[model samples]
Target: MRYGSVCSGIEAASKAWEPIGWKPAWFSEIEPFPSAVLAQHWPEVSNLGDMTKIADAVRAGDVEAPDVLVGGTPCQAFSIAGLREGLSDDRGQLTLSYVELANAIDAKRRERGETEAIIVWENVPGVLSSKDNAFGCFLAGLAGESSELQPAGGKWTHAGCVSGPERVIAWRVLDAQFFGVAQQRRRVFVVASARKGFDPAEILFEQDVGSGSTEANNVGVERRSSTVDNCTLYRFRRTDSYIDDGVSSTLSARDYKDRRELVVMADNRVRTLTPLEYERLQGFPDGHTLIQYGEKLADDAPRYKAIGNSMAVPVMRWIGERIAAALPAEKLSGDYGGSKTPPDQRDLWRTPPALFASLNDEFCFQLDAAAAPHNALCRKFITADQNTLETLWADYLNVPGYVWLNPPYSDITPFVKKASAESRNQIGTVMLVPADTSVGWFREAIETASEVRFITAGRLAFINPVTGKPVSGNNKGSMLIIWHPYPRTHCHFATVERDELMTFGAKLLARREAA
Candidate 1:
């Protein structure tokens, strides 16, 4: 299949694409660091220097038109990495380069007798909003002033030469971690193609789904830093999940040399990811990032810059898979062009399975029963993608036999002390807290836990499910604690020592679980 790439990096994608039997017809990239990485990795292809030079290529026709083009455009203008002035911002305007190339490619492809080619566009979720546009008028001329495509699916396609994807563009949000990547990354992708004979419904459904699309509706098409989906995701801020040891992490600027964020649980132990761990989080093949690449940059710069600019490969791979499923076989010719997967007989919009909600309700009901007395319960049944500490807290509380409280190691001393004291001031409870022996919270928990163990290291890790072993060594932060008071003779019924309970200074929140 004909394919082209722009805003290319070290070409981690080359691996994923090569397996699909797709060969790159063009490669475009910029910057010294990434170019070196790309050159070191993909030395064979025609490495076009810059995407901004695309308009010139179309004018000159040096860049041959292709049937399929894929790119994650330079998104600094739309990234949290910089001031997010969407289109108006110079960097955000880079997206227009992709759009310009799309238009140019299509026009030229028609000239070359190619009927329809695929256009895969990926970018930061923020670009979907107009409020972030910066360069304004300059962008008007970039992609021919076409409006942003609707972010729904199953609403556009062809019905046998009946004005197919013709001009209809479709888009959706997707994530990498769920496709088995170690990190949590979300992206938005848009697809546009000439209408020939396809179903708009299937096209819309594809864009509306295929991984990580459950979240678009949660947001109100507004723009205030397209960060997390909503405030429901802010529970990490109010608690200790941020420096989680096993779960891979976000690449923050400060954490470039090393994950500046360390997981410090209740025992004073600390854990954070190494650059190697960061590589795994981004879905690279094991040891894919050369040691020199990671080692050459002092500290975590290699890891930070490499992953920060990279797209969640799994998400894009999923897009490729969806595209593969929707498109006629690459060799489709003669008859299939006018063929139709008609309106009545289609599998694209199958009704969602009833089992997930049915089974999850049972899990929630059982979990809720167990965590009943302890006011900490999770709110609802969230999917695999549902890890917001707030939602988890609300939902966890609903489960039976558990009071899952993971408070931020630094800001949780007072809260932990309260949850601790409220356990009948002596009844047992389990808390997955930071092991920061130095932090007042850990000290408080340590001073009290009838049993405390070094479960694992966090702050950064690959994360083992049963034993909680981190992929990286245990040089970071955090440990788990299980506090159950020993049955001592009646000195004080459910005796809770004031020194141990000393961190308890705030009002305790005693609310019933949400039924």
Candidate 2:
């Protein structure tokens, strides 16, 4: 099959389809850096300068119109790094041009005997994420011309504008890591076809996000997901998995900086992969072509830009091949699996440290006595499930012993109520929680615990499931609140700097009440 590629990133489309005997008649890349890599590697291909110029030029070419047009446009303007100007913004508008060009191609194909042609495109995941449907609006604009966008009457926007489906865009957000990319890189796909009813939905899949996929349950908590079947390929292999169950590993940004914070296959001890490895992990073939150009770039530049900018070739090809199969072998047009585009893959939660603890005066009785010798501390070693949080409840307070508590954030209201009820009892409990002081739970924990020891620090120490070692410098800090043995309802107030809080949670645990 012959196709045309524009705004291609590192030629992922070329590599993905080349093995299938797919050939590219022409291609374009405006960026000199990636263009350099493409030229160095695939030197025989012809180049088109810009999408706007090439869109019409290709349409009018003496050669036949491409059955498939593939592009993964640059998305920095809408990325986190910049003000999310979207397609309306100048730099980001290139995406709109792609849609227009594809529409033009579809129209030209329609003028001829051709009834079907497919246009497959990719972009950052942020496109589909917005509640405003900003990206959707762009796709609607692409389906027709400026006329349909601004309908005259109440019909289809513009009364006299170009109407009907000139081109169809069916898209979904996907993570490269899910397709076997080592790092959690997300990209949105916009699959536009001149044919009606073409669907991109069949290729969409899901996998667990975040750390801890080997423990058989939630991270530092009980199992939340249902029975995990091992057969499902989340991304590709060794990709997305839950913290406590599946054998797959989490791909964190820390892998870029910390060598120890990586997943090593026990069989080979492949010390995790370099950023280059991360690229390969994501299905980019020999992106090492860009590596030689690194010396000209800054130290943090190569992997930083390459990984962020790359598309998982396997996932892309999977989507592309699906589109290709849906269409007639020589033509591009099919009904899309009805759906929307996808969003980016940036990490949502940066884990914070455990700060305040709640306890049942009975369960914590031993702990209180340990702080004051009034309660028995020696016999309080209670068996607790590592999956379920260990907590001090009301019944434990009645027992004449010290209480040990490690509670989950869930149902904190009951724990606070139990601790508050023991204002006069000789029991105290400490718990871990986020540092948000304004929350009612913190207020309750502070109001009831006889004495509060607010451990301040920056990053907290965590076990990187990827590395199984202390996520040392990677911690943002956490808290360990130790309530005094005495029974008095008192709440102390203080503030913690991020760095100090990080250190205090991971390295130092001073009583904030001290000074």
Candidate 3:
């Protein structure tokens, strides 16, 4: 397949898809460093520079109408770290331009009696919940909807599919760590096709067959030096530090100078990740960003930024393969059997330490009912191996302190029923779950719980069980379901700011540590 990429930071799509017989029609990157890197590597391919002009250029036949249109438009406006001006921001406007480019490519192809180009887009998961409905607008434009599509339950899920007048669209939030990268980088990927009988879901969703081991299809699996003390200390702090086990956090474009965002502690020394390590972490070859620009060697700052901004090569490679498998003539028939299953349903999203600390202080949580050894927030906890659902909570929490439960997203009904039952037996419980008010279980919680706290500051960035890093840009809003030992006559409802809780919790933990 020949593809055109826009906002092509270092052309990660080209690098990932090239090995599988896919070719690049052209690239649209304006950054000096990344543009130079593209020229140095693939000099023959033209750099279209400004993406806003690509639609006009393609319409004028100045550029090839590729078989596929792939791009990860500027996400800052939609990123939680940014001002989040959404479509009002100039950068966020590029998302619309991307749709125009896709339409232009398909228009040119249609004139030639060819099939419509497949559209692949990637962005921070924050886009799904943008206040301006940025994702809904983009999807509407791509799907040819007469009006903007609203997410069910007023929030987008991690995965879903939609069919519209123009195209069939499927989207899912994928984590780089699952694709063989060590970083806990979670980003939303959307695939759309206008072809008749084509199901975009086939390209993005995978069947849960086999042993569920990703080893067989691991990509760019590079070996790194063992941890200095048998455990790598991954720390992220606002003013204080907390240690956790696992891989690195998401590498950001500003990570080069943002020491507090991610810190590596080894052998009693603290330091920042090197540029070369950034490249490797993104599944690029060592020194992939250390390219020759005009005369002098490229500086470390630009290299760090470029690599950090790029997508994880392995994850992109997997997507490319899936797309290829769904191409014309080679498309597989019959249901994949797992397309509708939420991709993150089984993931162990540990509660953020600061938030947990604050809640623990308020409730004196003595038992972590749903936890693994690596992500347990309390000294006393039950593991998956123990079958928390099958086992009695009274057996674990003999004393009668509050219980904290962040159950698997796959199914929260059983846990809710259990919590309600436990509460009736004089056990208090606090459960963190998606605020999906439409569900029966959610209504049940409202009726049975003493209080329901809707986390309104923002979507809580839950910690990844494997990486020990907080996965930001959570797609849905969260809420705390509190059940007191004695049921209240009426349930109290309140809104809490996650940032405030986190800050207060962090300071409390810091004072405790100092003491």
lDDT scores in order: 0.47, 0.48, 0.78
Better model by TM-score, 2 or 3? 3
Candidate 2 residue-wise lDDT, 80-194, digit = tens: 5445766666767777777767766655454432445576777666655433345555666766644424323422210011223555445555554444343445566666655
lDDT (Cα, tens digit) per residue for candidate 3, span 1-515: 67899999898898799788787878999999999999989996789899999898677655777878998999898998877889999999999999898888878666544568889999999999999999999899999998889999999898999988888999988877766555768899999989766688877766764322143333345433322233463746445765453557788888767644344454555566678767766888777788887688898888878887889887789888887877644322221111111244334667888999899889988889988787788888899889887777776675466899987776677888888888887888999987667666788777789999988745676665555666553434688999998757988999998788899999989998999
How big is the positional error of residue 342 in model 1, measured in Å on the Cα after superposition?
A: 24
Clashes of each: 76, 66, 0
**The best candidate in terms of TM-score:** 3
Model 3 bad stretches (over 4 Å): 209-242, 261-266, 329-515
TM-score, per-candidate, Cα-based: 0.51, 0.47, 0.60
**Cα RMSD (Å) between model 3 and the true structure?**
27.0
Could you tell which candidate, 1 or 2, scores higher by lDDT? 2
Clashing pairs in 3: none
Candidate 2: lDDT of 111? 44
Weakest lDDT window of 10 consecutive positions for candidate 2: 338-347
